[model samples]
Target: MPRSILSWSDRSLAAQFALAGGVVMVLSMLLIGRVVAARIEESVVRNSALATSQYMDSIISPLSQDIAEADTLPPGARRALDEIFTNTPLGERVASFKLWKPGGLVVEATDKTIVGRRFEVTDSLARAFAGEVRAEFQNLSDEEDRGEHALGLPLLEIYSPVREVWSGEVIGVAEFYEVATGLERDLAEATRNSWISVALVFVAIGGVLFLIVLRGSRTIDRQRAALTRQLGELEALSTRNTALRERVQQAAARASAANDRALRRIGADLHDGPAQLLSFAALRLDALRGQLAETGEIDAVERAVKDAIREVRGISKGLGHPDIEDRGPCEIVTGVAETHEARTGTKVAVICDLPEGLALSQAEKLCLYRFAQEGLNNAWRYGGGRGQEIRLDCRDGRLGLWVRDAGPGFPPEDAERHEAEDYSGIGLAGLRDRVESLGGSLTAGNRADGAGAEIGMELDLRGA
Candidate 1:
């Protein structure tokens, strides 16, 4: 019930059982010992009383015969009782004696002052009148027992019935008190032995149970300690793995940014060197067309050079990412969509619902730019540029982008096939990897309406 006791109990199963079982064993031993001691004393007292009553009846029954016909004993019977007390060997053992008639009248007594005095009828007196004997040891609370109380000796009080000689009818009661110092000593020894035996048995049983519980408690404690150590090791390993994962993510992001910068540099090189050379060759062919005799060949050569220049410029444009470091998410998305529309000559619907002040890292912005570029390019190529839409918004602390087109969606096998194949181009697989590097996800599938294909990406802005 107290905090300290609760803590002790929590220490182990054996300690708890010891505390509870010890209390139960002690109480059980005490109860059993008390009952056994009481029964032993009662048995000893009753046997002694029965033997004394039988002997006393042989001597006093004839002397008390006058009580069957009269309430008072005659003088001769009274003198016989007095001589038995004064001169007989039985007098040395017995402390007091009485003869009674019906209605609680004491016809004769060793204490002569009580002769012919009436008292309340007790249960023992009633049972004796009905032909039963009753006895008690050292119980001197009765009014008639005052003299015996003063004697201060352990006494056995007995009530025995007196019978009429001719009719064998119980007509009166004889009550006596016998000294019981020997019986009291025997009872005291027996009680002590009984208590000791009960206590020993209880202790033995409790010890056996406690030993069994202690064995089990020790096993459990060992197992618990082992489990605790294992759990601590697992926690340490988990912390190390988490730190490694963060490092990997940061490396991926940095690599993506560096790759974007490299592509931008390549784009500038193509536009400035090869593209300019192809444009100058096409101009020289146009000027030399008028002087050539075969104008058809000259015109065809000029057209091929101009077409190569256009292809190189397109490759350069596609390789470069727009400047988006200074822009918010909404502006970046809108700028990419507008650029896609301008280059492809296809109408792309743009919807921006991004929150105010939405911030993004440089790597994240590059990823977003590439995502929009690839998504719209796929829509225009596969969907014939019909119903192309780019949706961007921030919801529930996450930033999301979706590009949808009214076209037959990707087949189920397309995703599996893409994963198994290797490609150097910037495609959906590449975009997926870039998104994942920044702790985002990309999914390309059919729209829920079943009328179009959709490419969606979601980024948790909390980390950003």
Candidate 2:
């Protein structure tokens, strides 16, 4: 299982370039160091070769003087020259000399037996005979074999013109061998110096780079923290916006309900209070009319007075005013039936099946009373002016107020269905608004049980 990085900036680039750079730097230090050391070795070898050449020149000068001073052909003098030439060292870095006649013939050599051979023979000898310093490296073809024995080995050969002391004529060729112990020593010294320098350089670069990375990391952390705080603020603002919208919706619903309740209360006041006062005054005027007939004191004035009181009572009832809330819904329904009995000579059946002291709110009680008043008024005024009966019931969690008549029920589409002026019990529309808001239902039409008209309402026990 791999662990996740807990922070953003702790990761380092572990890649090929870093590894390669380390490897290359080490290898380069080794190689360049070797080159520097070898140069030192070559310099020492060159110095030794030059010193050896000078020593060989001293020996050659004395031998040539002794040979030139021999005026007669003497065997002893020849024997001495041969001994001196044969005494040369065979080690590397020693000069190997060759003498040539003016006609390009080899007369003497550092190799005593091969002396007197023609100078125009092998390629190296032919080049030397032409007065050129025929220098070469590695007798064979290996690159590391460079700068070794060097005659026919790794060597840098210098050919100086050797002349006879008296005649000043060209004589032999001199070749010096270069060796490379100095090159190896110098390369080792260079390797040590370069390693220290490269290490110090890398340390300085790494330190600077690390500091820059550290500062950058701190700046990024600060930015991230600030952004997180801003995000938190934005989230809080969003929550406040949502709460404000909810409060606004609640306020709108409450305002609409308040307007409906106010209209209902106004209607109830007109129907129950003012309307009944006017109606009672009209009944007194009819009594006054009887008295006027007996006294004959301005009969026209008494008739006009009664007419005016009746009109005022009609106006109040149309505005939904009446004295009805004083009694219980059961008593109101039964009394309206008694009025129907008196005015149209009809009977009404009313039943009360509610729990004792079954209380109700002001709006619900008013609605029940208004419904009963209109039912009785409809029976007295329009049920053939005579013979109809209404049945009312209260039962199991409901007040079932209904009225029925034997007179012709109006059509379902009658203009009086919800007309306030026609029905007048604080208006059918007002009854519906109150009952339904309390989770009850009201309906008006012909009775489902019979052919006469019926109007009934139901109230939920809990809601009422």
lDDT of 2 by residue, 45-90 (tens): 4565456556656665445443333322145534654555455343
Give lDDT for model 2. Answer: 0.54
> lDDT per prediction?
0.84, 0.54
Q: Which run of 10 residues does model 2 get worst, by summed lDDT?
A: 140-149
Model 1: per-residue Cα lDDT over 1-464, one tens digit each = 99997898677889889998899888988899999999998888888878988888888899888888788888898888888988668888888998888899999999989988999998889999999888988788989889989999989899988988889899888899888889889999999999989988998999999999999999999998999999999999988987787788789988877777787788789899999999889888888987878899888888888888888888888888667879887777788889878977989888989767777888878877888878888787777788899999889988899989997767666732222111114788778888898788988887888777888899888865
Find the number of clashing residue pairs for candidate 1.
0
C-alpha RMSD by candidate, in order: 6.8, 23.2
Best by lDDT: 1
Error in Å for residue 62 of model 1:
3.8
